[model samples]
Target: MSAEQDSVFVRNFALVIATLVGVTVLLIVIANSVFGDMDPERQALAEERAEQNLSPDFAVRLSGEPAPAIASADSGADEGGVTEVRSGEQVTQAVCIACHQGNFLNAPGIGDKAAWNERIGKGWETLTQNVADGYGNMPAQGGAASEEEIRAAIEWMVESETGLEVPES
Candidate 1:
């Protein structure tokens, strides 16, 4: 072929290759958006593989370590909540600190005057109820043992931050 024709042919071939690559990438993106992270067949295969990988004594081995102690049925444990009656400080350390200390998930930091004031104006009952019901990113009772524990934790946070008393229920 002539030089100009050869150049044209090479350019066309390059364009075709580039187009094919672009189309492949676009298809991958569309598949990810449409199919999401898990495909039913893939999930089933993964589960099967996981099961197969387990040893014959898998059940026994899994519980080899004694499970951490969960609180007893009593001690004011609410439905779908833990039984352990954790002190405000303990609860703060265990769960509240995760979000509250640094305000992760838009949580009011411990002793954030401005943040606490906004909710404090809403009244203690409303605040505690919100805690029980899981306001915003906070899971119900902030995953505390019970409503009482949740209240205590909130009170502790509020009192420490704003020096205002939140009555106990």
Candidate 2:
């Protein structure tokens, strides 16, 4: 083929490859977004993402070692948030922090804005409402009966995850 024809062919091939790669990445992100929230405890902590990014099946096998602070799951040994509790720190400590602690719930890994953007896209109030009413794997009031407790829990989680100050209105 002529030089110009070769260049055109190469450009088209590059475009096709680039498009395919873009679609693949988008699919990966969407899949991760949809399924990353499955319970990823110390038993399976290396998870798909961690396996893809961190050590290979390392978190799952570290059973004898202490379960490090998880990304966002609470193995609440205290039966956390089962009743009316208004302490922000407590509610958060008891409840939301588990799944909200890190990237466990397709989360932004506590303080990662990029991870929270879409949730924030729904508006903070809406997000708060979801926490109050329960969304997906999360329980209502994050399993707390008290509104204040739930708000507090959400505020703590939001602040920790995004560093954004929640207003009391």
TM-score of each: 0.46, 0.39
* Candidate 2 residue-wise lDDT, 47-105, digit = tens: 65566776643447555644444443434533422233456777767766677676565
- lDDT of each prediction vs. the true structure? 0.77, 0.65
TM-score of 1: 0.46
Clashes of 1: 0
lDDT score of residue 150 within candidate 2: 65
lDDT of 1 by residue, 1-169 (tens): 7999999999999999999999999999999998777978999998998997784634454746644344675745554546457787787888788899998999998988888877776777788788787888888764555777877787788786578665543
lDDT of 2 at 51: 68
- Measured by lDDT, the strongest candidate is 1
